[model samples]
Target chain A: MSRLSDLGEFGLIAHLEKILPGGVSKEWSVAIGDDCAVRRSSGGRSEFLTQDLLFEGVHFLPGNSKHWETVGWKALAVNLSDIAAMGGEPVGAVIGLGLPKRAKLREVEALYRGLARAARRFSCPVVGGDTNRSRGGWTLAVTVLGETRRRPLLRSGARPGDSLWVTGELGGASLAWRAERKGKKIPAAMRRRLLLPTPRLEWGGHLAAFGEVGAAIDLSDGLAGDLGHVARASRVGFDVDLETLPRPRGFAGLCERVGVDALEAMLEGGEDYELLFTLRAGAEKAFGDYARSRGLKVARIGRARRGSGIRWFENGREIPRRFGGYRHF
Target chain B: MSRLSDLGEFGLIAHLEKILPGGVSKEWSVAIGDDCAVRRSSGGRSEFLTQDLLFEGVHFLPGNSKHWETVGWKALAVNLSDIAAMGGEPVGAVIGLGLPKRAKLREVEALYRGLARAARRFSCPVVGGDTNRSRGGWTLAVTVLGETRRRPLLRSGARPGDSLWVTGELGGASLAWRAERKGKKIPAAMRRRLLLPTPRLEWGGHLAAFGEVGAAIDLSDGLAGDLGHVARASRVGFDVDLETLPRPRGFAGLCERVGVDALEAMLEGGEDYELLFTLRAGAEKAFGDYARSRGLKVARIGRARRGSGIRWFENGREIPRRFGGYRHF
Candidate 1:
């Protein structure tokens, strides 16, 4: 029998999907394969549901490597990112926690404090959940429920003429990850960006309600892989200009210090948790102004074109798709 | 600092609750501390959400001991039971899975087949979820979304005069568990009761719509523990008649074979997935008749009183509470 490592994460998902009974319900607006499952609720509104699981060793390490609080924050933040990707207002979340038998009460408390911090910051309360003893390692599974007044943003909504835009800069998470690996102290700002990613709730809500953005997805699996998802779903091609991609402050210096290519980090690093989307023509200036007003960064880096596959250009030369970002397996 | 086992499961939940902000929302009809969290969705309908997690070694043992298919069935069935407790129709579900690196693709397929079985039986489609690599054992976390047109049955709604009723038999799961512990082959029927519990969705819906059952909960954490939850939530006392408790066919023989007490199994055994509910006085006959017509067993075993604490009785004598049931910590 083929092992899970051989199938890889995405391959396993596809295999499981084929064996599962129901695909999409007629009552649901969107189902499996989206950032969030969307169903029409009572008040002519759309309800979105998403779930994510984070496992120790696979997602993060305990001990001095990472704080339990930061682990908890990222656990919930990933789910919140799914809701934000759909332009939905998160209402509540249920967390299913599996802790090792030897876990300390203080560590659990610290984790809850981190979860509470994120909950309050996003106004999405931690409502209810289940907890159990784990004979193995710790695991945190978070499920978030949200609602949208308008139609939810979908990765399949991008059109050929739409310009691709991204929120915030990339490579900071990669920098922090490298720093942690090298036993070097990471800057607080970089660590926060890596550990406690802020889901663009307000920005996504505004875009869904007023902005002319078409398709949207969260950058949890780096720009290349996530953009590939949008491209595949929308059945369109993308031409991204590497020069136009936004970089964090001191990004070049950080990459140089780590002996890595800055452009590679921006393209292939995961856990950025920024929003990647497509905008209508002539809407870039307005969107940029809105981001400036809100103290958020918006970068226009690519455009959807009539065709298939993602092509990259760095200073007028096509860059081959060498890597497809992070893979869990 | 104290360890998690020092606090125990319930105590840890209470501790976490105190530190977490935003307990209840005005917009939510029901928040935490229930079988499921409920909120009013658009179009005058109530939406219910509940989550559960199952961990290997903690909840089950894979490989030669237990079938992965049965594990998948129980994982989804537990969540379905929560929806039944709320008297709601399950709309969809999201499952977050964590698998060890050595997991086989065939085993994963078997697990999905079991999940598909339950989903088809309950009409709750597997809509969306996330999967990741696990450094430890496997974990399955499921979140179910459901809707109810009528008022949801809450654990806090039982009145002073309500009669407690349970659908289906108990003790079968305990018998199966004992058999497994003894390394003896469990009866196929008993094994099915333990591993593939049927959620009482129809009965719960009927009770919610017409039978006047007030408070309801699914039997997961034994009769003693779950009934205590109802008593505490409703602020009422319960008087349970031990003699009136329903037992599975050949339950006495199985208990005798396993060298266990049948009564203890009935009171302290868990994973029954039976619906434990309270009906208004005079509604028993109608409810019983409805259940009979539907070929289901309904046992009236107790009553709610105007006080706190859960008390047991046997033949006009009070039976002191011996054990408080299973603790995760």
Candidate 2:
């Protein structure tokens, strides 16, 4: 008889994983507790199924039409990140919209306009949806179907001694959030990154095609939290060198000006939408070659080890664990 | 510049259909404005995708744990009915859940238990989903994927002079709704029908296999309003004999006791989840034979005509058109 607030986000998911059935059935390769569920029908390629819900006021404000458009882009982009985490290309998407009675018709249209923009960019068709009147703020749920010929990446694939790496940089979204809360001006680049994240679909596809990449996850839960997922799934521990972690330009300076701890932001901030993955031992050179050839900037920041949870280190000194990432509950 | 309240539900959908792109694409046979979006991929059978959103207060009240469980069942069942409307078998489903901060852990678990029950009943696997915190009431969005080897039924397939038919009795849900609104005790059977509807998956599959059913739609929006959808989509009209409409046992008596118009409830009350379809000319007998063999109770109620809108009649007298069905807005 506990409240959901006590269980928190991951706790609720854990409960669902136990109560729900049909994990890896005959037609499914994977089910719950992953970036996307993998279904493999006979004579057909494996498909990925993922869904994300965004609530107004919780996820975004019911602002102007322009802001609503960006919210729409972000709603679909987050689900696309899940597809990218699985190294699959999106096939189609269906959206479920719950709008309050007072919402404007133009705002709904603008939301779709943003959704259409992302769909076109990712080559995923907006297939169908259901709309209903809500007693609350706006609710947008997008479910994307993805397909892949290669073996889709999973968080359980990482082994001890694997090198941990991340694409692009971290802490931008978190920084923007902290700055906005403190009534400080957010950096324009960080604000854009927060509003409209570019899913690393190409990089994920390349990693899957390389065939030697280990566990992978999108950085929606920041480095410390996402690595914990990989660690638990892969039964391995991570030793991250905080100094080697990639950060957005002037991220530390901006955090200092806003009186927010940059290290805490980089480790626990959510919604970065960057890919964090591991490479098998001795495949680093080959992986680096492929990444460079594709003009992808990736940084090796840590190594998986024979332990549990994440052990953060800075300049060979162990840092005490503090942040627990972002949780909705 | 108008509000969504002004345009209403269907009007917003029509606006979206025009604004959104990639309808009937190379890999998609149907997109929007149908029971489900049909996807025809190479080397794979056609797949249907649909989504539905249910909000607390709008769709249901957040009562006890048992009520939450029924809410979960209805959320998935409605999506299953969409697949049933298309004559397709559900492959898998992904749900997006938005829970208020004060929601209970047991309530969420109970909700999943109900979802598990419906998923097991239909053999549609609940694969993956996203859970988020809401600033308002609970929001459940479900997207189901369905597969069909036979040609899926469409609302636009009915021709002039085709016989319209419906599976099972109607007005049970609508009657219960009226009873609840009037603070009257509803019949147990009617209450159950409103809470947990059985999607006619097998009957729909049979209709698709028969390949002679003209058009199909699930009676979610009541008899008269759903007919309007088929009429507009197929570019035909309907002539329904109100006397021939099937009703639950004591439906009229209950409506009369509750001070509700029986005819209006039968025509415009929603959430029936029954299959409303048309039989091709000369296929009625064969269809009846199949339905009888399957222990299905079906009745012929009307005919599609070469005109616009619906014309109701009883015993050679035309009834005035009044009810427009249940609308959220």
Candidate 3:
């Protein structure tokens, strides 16, 4: 078992810096070690910024977050997913953690390691942040800044004729979480899926270049809920085919026992962190080819129409729920 | 008493978005309802980011920050201070709030108002963030994104003989917090100074352009603690002349009554959030000129020496202290 005493906070930060890519230079401008990282956005590109906070018990249960490193990776991954949904490139992030004193230093250091790994992978630096001891539960918050070369993918851009596409499998996380919560046996692959989520970075750039990907939002909050957000914003309705959701291996049968539609799990069970986006109707083949060449899963889950809300199809009949999606508030 | 109910959460968001100089739209490249904002970067500009988490009982007592609006304003102010110290041009921010259920709707609206007011004042937008009900007191965690043009003011850049400069008066916050705690009537001016700190945004730009603001840091955890970070990072020592330290209004009298070093308040008191930077010789004139033009206080509190550690002065002699500086951990 590793301990924070093995690598002090400075050592931890050094580890992170060492792992990150070498794009930083004095001229690139960073003001660190004080309170903030001072930067000069003299570059011609537009800047994108967003922040997300995860509080224990509120955002994730203890076992759901698993290890501190997983929490850190998930933090950066979730933020990166946001950027990816907008077809933005990750640059830097500031992390603020309100850690309960009960947390171990080893866990904190491991958490940094996970963050550093993701930052290195994404070429974003851990510029500057604040840490404090909290009397409450552990809280992790990160604000990420990114840039894009062209127009961003917005949920409001989806039109009635657009076809929705999702990257990778969904419902795996919900299955994994439920299994883990019940202390049931989960396959190692499913366990991994539940932990580290790959933010669709490469596909994000492609989607942006294609100009066919209309409105897009990430599936941090499952499909139904996030789609509801898109629908509410765009004032359009969607009809989802229940059979189209890509469930993780071993969970297909469980969906039947749960007495709920698997599509509902795909729509409402969150933590998938995939890009759920709509593209121009005619661009489906192009997207399919793009996904096939990328060795990715691009599913045709639904279609946008000139209507009001979302509806799921089961046995050629419409199944509706009172609530459209999960409410985190 | 204006209530948050007057501006519900969605209403508050709309209000903030509406008040921005250029409200969120396609112009944002990426705006609300998406995961993150994506913009293009400036030439040679790296993204600079910082997060400021304002705790109700910890960072602020029940007096000043007890009101949600002031809490929001101060939270944004602290983050802005971080951005300013880095000499980063402010772009935008995200507010991650942990609000108690007991907090009134008006208070929440006022909080958003304060948030919008500061965002517009700093020319930064409040892009996207997370808010949740808290079991404890309010926690306003604000993360800001900024950029620099050329050289970044880093803590590692200070050399021996560099003149250490402070941007403005400190210790008003301590007095304010104490006043509010004691329920004493503080002057309206003092109260304003304490409750709302104006970050030195313009001064930061001057420091970066001057080409001799060797190393800089924001004084958030008081002067001694924050400057100690710079000194340690640069591997240099510092000697502060007591006479050169700037004192706030009525500070001298207050120090006399307390029977303590007035300079220590400037040194160890927390939440000043002013810029404390070291300048190479010959750059002082330009820096001083800019500060004066900006109607700000400039203090040559110390100078970097060859050795490490810091020393304080009483008239002409070195002074000793019981403990080192303000403790954040």
Candidate 4:
């Protein structure tokens, strides 16, 4: 709890190093002891960079019974998904934190513990950062450095004949939030599904090297919303087969409990943290085979069309998108 | 005016791009159109990096007349000082802003304009950024990147015999802040001193190439406070000659209006953004010559000692540090 200036630049940094579970690796040629950090990419590997900001209240409410560690985990997980979307492996991350002066020392430490856990899990270093006192709420800004060997997958270049696919079913996070709010005693298995998301990085990297995917995106904003992004970015439309859409097991009953259609969940409920990608029509079999070998479920949901806009088909009936996904503005 | 999510990612980004002034140059490799921005770095040239955060209430008051542009400039200025300490030239910067949802659009746009002006003046690009809604107060976090060819300076390199020196005068910001509060008008030149901080980046960079300075720091946290940082970091003590400290021509008169000690103001008031450094005793003449030629006044304010702790001497009489400095927490 020392004042930033009083601790002095060096003392402040040393204090931060002590709090970290383990130190950054030797890849950091110029680390915390210097004016700035310096690290060379693993001998000519291209650098992959992405940043995310988590503002208190907007990202998470302080009163939520959900633990801070989980918040830390999901924050990093979501950004990692962005790198995964690029078919890259995470190397390290720098965190910039703004906390109100009144914030508890214990809470701050816990937040870093969560950050450290995520770093260790992803095998990325919690490299360097800035910790400042805020006038109001806490804010976390993270910039991740990732590495790619083959090539980076971008959101452009989807062909009209390419097939679009998604990994895992969506809507679990929305349902989890509701359940948490209602204090529903859901089973540990489903609760974990809602809380801890799996980043499809490994699958995406292999898909990139396999030369099968033309464009890729992560389902951070649900299928309908993020698919729209890829389609727009690629200047193509999509025709999704409703019947082909994957559903969560026992999803129908869960939809009934919520008084809504299960299709809505699959299309628009976000925080899935799953990868959505497009592949050449002829590459589906091999792609599917590779995914299954990795124990991941690949759902062929739609096809890229020459036109703009998305349409859904089910049992010979075509339907329009009732809901796309969440928006922040 | 737009629910951020409603704006959608592309639409929101376009809005930002349109509102922000066009880039001064092509330093940004990927710019705003990609999944992540790519930049020129040390692989090309040694890069300087620093991130700073300013929270509402702590840094500024609600309904304060200070425009968002000032806040934006201040954020960039503070980080610029860090790079300046390392004697690096500004290249580009990224701003991650979090605002209370209720903030006006004009305020946000002004913030960008302020950022744009700073970028143009410093010859740094507004490469990229992240924006989100804060649960409560508005927060502005800026990460600045700079470049240098010389060995980066650090706070731990000062030797016991090194003479301590400071560029320009200190404590002008505290005087300006006090003047603004008392409803007293300061002269336009003095006002500019408070509103626009002069970053000694080029000066520091030149100093670094000369390679005579032992250790260095920027005076963003007032002189005593920031000097204390260097003292502790170097594990050495310093004695400051207060009589040699340059006084802003207009500052001595403010003691009466603000009911504060001018000396104390010079000691603890911050945001001067001046470089404070230590150099080997024999290099004093060269340092003085260089400083004089550049129209920059340099003074031999102290000496680094074998032990730790900072002491101030006025008329060669040792004086106690009445106050440390302004600290956020």
Candidate 5:
């Protein structure tokens, strides 16, 4: 029998998808392999459903290394990113929690407070959930229900001539994680970006509504890995200029202090929770204007090509792939 | 700081509900307190969403006591029961899985096969989900989306004198559990009841369509505990007769061999996945006809009263509470 380590996370998902039934209902417009599953609802709106699971040791440390509130924020934040990736507005969420029997009520209360804060911030209500005792460590599984007036964004719609764009800066989360692992203090701004990622719902909504965006995905799995998903799904190749990648504030200084490569950090850092999308060639000018009006900074860093797979370029030279984002298995 | 054991499972839920936001969306009709959250959808059908979490050591014994496929079946079956309680037809579902790094691909495949089996049986498609490696034991969280053309049933609708009815038999699950814990052989029928429970979707749909069913809930937490939920929600009391409670086939023999009280086993046995509902007095005859025609056995177990709280009686004599069902904390 093959082990899960041999298949890895994506391979396991693909294997399961083959064995599981799909499109059993006519309502399902988009099923598995997307950021969110889309169903055709009434009133010309599409209902989007997405879920994410976070474990104590796999996703975050449980004890003094992380605050319970930040842990709670991250659990819901990841699901929100999924919604944002699909260009939908979240309406409600259900949290399925599994905690150790020895967990304290005060800690659980604090965790909910953080969750509540995020819910209110995103206008997504916590509608229902189930809680159970776990003999293992903590597990938080959140499912977000959302809707969109326009067609939900997908990773398979990118055209060959489309320009790839990214919202906000990256690499801060990876730097903060490295610092935390070394017992070094993380900057307040970097820590917030790492622990409490803000899902770009407003920006994604504009992109989807404007009708010029090609494909979109969230940068939860780092630039290289997530872009690879879009490339594979869209059947196109990407030539990303490494120098054009936007770095977070003080990111270069943090990389120097932490003894990490800045370009590698920007390329392979995970958990940024920013939106990476493709736009038509001339749509970039209109998009830039709209983003500027909204006080949002978006960078055009790459272009989709006729071939397949993602390749990195620096100063007109190709950079060999050496590192990627976090792997579950 | 109060420990989770101090509040127990229900108390912890109550505490979290107080802190969590409820009904922030205009679409939410029923939130937080029911088997599923109901939302007014566009096509006049009410959408219902419910989730359940199962832990490895707390919910089942991983390798020795149960097969991986049974574990997956139980995880999805419990969520289907919630949809059945709300009298809705499941359209789609998302499963969030947390597995240890050492998990085998063959075991995972078997688990998905069980999930696929239940999905086919109920016609609820497995749409989307997230999977990650866990440092602790295995965890499965399932969220089901359902819809009903009739008004969704709630636990708050039972009026005084409404007849309490239950679909199918109980006690087999608890008996099977005890035998498994003691490493004794479980009867084939009991094992099926314990491992592969069938959700009462058709009966629940009829009850909802008939429009005479009052309050409803699934028998996941035993007769006594789940009835308490309906009583508290409806602000009515229940007088349950121990004699009328339906026992599974060969239940008496199993109880004698297991050294368990038959009454306690019938009342406190959980994970039965049966539907417990209240019917208007005269509606019982029609319900009985429908059930009989469908080859389903439903028993009128009790009636709702004017006061609150649930009480057990035996042939006009009151029986004091001896035990309740499983507690998470």
Candidate 6:
């Protein structure tokens, strides 16, 4: 007799995990709980499968062509991030789009064009889909299929003494949200970071190729929450050095001007779509060299340790905190 | 500048086909414009992928636990039918579900249970999925992955001399719709057929094993409209013998009471989920014997010929027709 609101998002997932049959099969190595389900394919490769859903009002604002296009990009980008988290290469995607009766064909086409553009960028084709008329707002459900020749990265591989690293800057999504809420126009760079996140596919694939990186996750649910998932799955904890964390240009000033806490925004902001992975201790120098060689910026922001939850420190002083990032419900 | 309503569902699909890259690859034998996208997997087998979407208030009524359960079942069932249409055995499925905030936990559990039941019945596991909260009604998008050792069937395989056959009676879905529209109580049998259709998986697999069946399509868009797809794809026409079509018990009487044309209902009502396939000339007797051994009911309802579109006849006399079946937009 309980309502969905009471269970929250993670609770609901846990409930489903209990009720449904074991998500794994003979060919599948990982299933429901992972970022992407992994299935053993031929040629020493494993396939990754992930799905994501975005609703009109819930996920995006219904507007002109640009808005629809951005929605389309995000719908596929999020699922691609799942594959990236698994250190997989793109194969293809299927989009299930639901449009209201009054939807314009041009807008719908623009959406498809946006999806096609992203597919081409990642070398993944739009293979097939289903389109239907809806009695509600527009819904875009995208499922991406990917493959990896190397062993797939997983959240459960993190261990105590592993160095935590992240790609790109954080807090861009939160800064954009705060700017919009305060009636301030978002900066062009920040807006792009917020709305058009580039999945770190190459970086993730490189991590897998290195064979020394312990575990990885995408920063979709903010650093604290997502790292918490890695911590729980790997039965470890994290100690983040606040000062070492990379920030978007003018991040602190923008947060202060918008009347938000800069450090909190960086730690708890969601949808950054950056890679948060752990490398074995002493492997940092070599990994940093590799990152620089690839022209990718990576920062060692924290370290995994023997504990239960994330512990934060600013200049070696423990900072007591609360705020577990975004929850959909 | 056209609205979606102007182009309709098929028109939108045609538009997408032109704008996107050729939905094919070195490993993919078929992609867009087929029951399932076929990818050459390992072990001399090819994989089939298909997706389907169902929206609340458009495809079903949102009510109590039973209604949610039925919706979940139909969501996966329709995708299975697509795999069945390709004459493939399902390997697994992924579901994307969007629920309104008010959706009950108990009901969602019931829905998942129903999905699990169907998955067990067909031996297709629910391997993965994404669930999100929506700003609108419930939405279910399901993608099924299947595989076949035999060559997958295609609509373009129909030849001029093929015999058209259908498994199960027609008009049940149309009758259910009519009865509901007229505020009349729908008979239990008709309602079950409409909502909980049994995909003709065994029959489709058998046809593919026979290696002589030409084209095949699931009866989701009614016989006439779906047959039109095969006709266009194979460059062959059809002459349907209306008298030979098997009707649900009391179909005509129910249609008459609801003020609907029985013939139109039988030819144009959608969601039957029956197998409509073409067989090579003079193979009916052998196929019939196989069907009898398997306890499957099938009837020869038409003949493929060298023409352009479907021509309907009643008792060898042409019956002029206008209805072209269901279009979502």
lDDT by residue for model 2 over A136-253, one digit each (tens)? 9988889999999888899899999999999999889989888888899987899889988999898889888989989999999888888899999999999999999899888777
Tens-place lDDT digits, model 5, residues B22-77: 65368898888899999888778899999988887778666632388888777888
Can you list each candidate's DockQ?
Answer: 0.78, 0.76, 0.14, 0.13, 0.76, 0.71
For all predictions, the C-alpha RMSD in Å is: 2.0, 1.7, 12.5, 12.4, 1.9, 2.0
Clashing pairs in 2: none
Candidate 6 residue-wise lDDT, B1-329, digit = tens: 67677788988898877767667988777878888888887778888888887788888887788877777777788889988888999888888889997788888898898788788778888878888898889888898888898999998889999999998899898888778778888689998887777887887887788877999999998888999999998999999999999998777778888888888788888888998899999898888888798887889999999988999888999977765968888
Q: How close to the true structure is residue A51 of candidate 5, measured as C-alpha lDDT?
A: 95
Write model 6 residue lDDT over A272-328, tens digit each, in one string.
898999999989888888888887788999899998799998899988986586888
Output the TM-score of candidate 2.
0.97
Candidate 4: count of backbone clashes, pairs at least 3 residues apart or interchain: 10
Name the 10 consecutive residues with the lowest summed lDDT in model 5 chain A.
A57-66
How would you encode candidate 3's per-residue C-alpha lDDT over B178-250 as one tens digit per residue?
6666666656766776778788788888778777788887876778877777787789998888777776768
lDDT of 4 at B225: 78
- Once fitted onto the true fold, the runs of candidate 3 whose alpha carbons sit more than 4 angstroms away are A1-46, A63-66, A257-261, A320-323, B1-41, B44-46, B62-66, B258-261, B283-294
Interface RMSD to the true structure, each candidate: 1.4, 1.3, 17.9, 18.2, 1.4, 1.2
lDDT of 5 at A22: 69
State the lDDT of candidate 4 residue by residue for A1-329, as single tens digits.
33433443234335434422222344332232211223335445544556667887777656432376677677777778877887888755556777664565446555655666676677655544566666667788876666576656767758899998887777666666666776665556556766677677887787777787888888876788888777776889988888887767776786677555677667777877788889998998888788878776788888998988787888767875566776555
Off by over 4 Å in 5: A23-25, A64-66, A321-323, B64-66, B183-186
Query: Candidate 4, after superposition: displacement of residue A150 in Å?
Result: 4.6
CAPRI band for model 1: medium
TM-score of each: 0.96, 0.97, 0.82, 0.81, 0.96, 0.96
CAPRI tier of model 4: incorrect
Task: List the global CA lDDT of all models.
Answer: 0.86, 0.88, 0.68, 0.68, 0.86, 0.85
Model 3 lDDT tens row, A138-253 = 77788777767666777777899999878888887777777776667767776777788888877787788778888888887778778877887678998887777777765778
Query: Which is better, 2 or 6, measured by DockQ?
Result: 2
Better candidate by DockQ, 3 or 5: 5
Query: Model 6: which docking level applies?
Result: medium
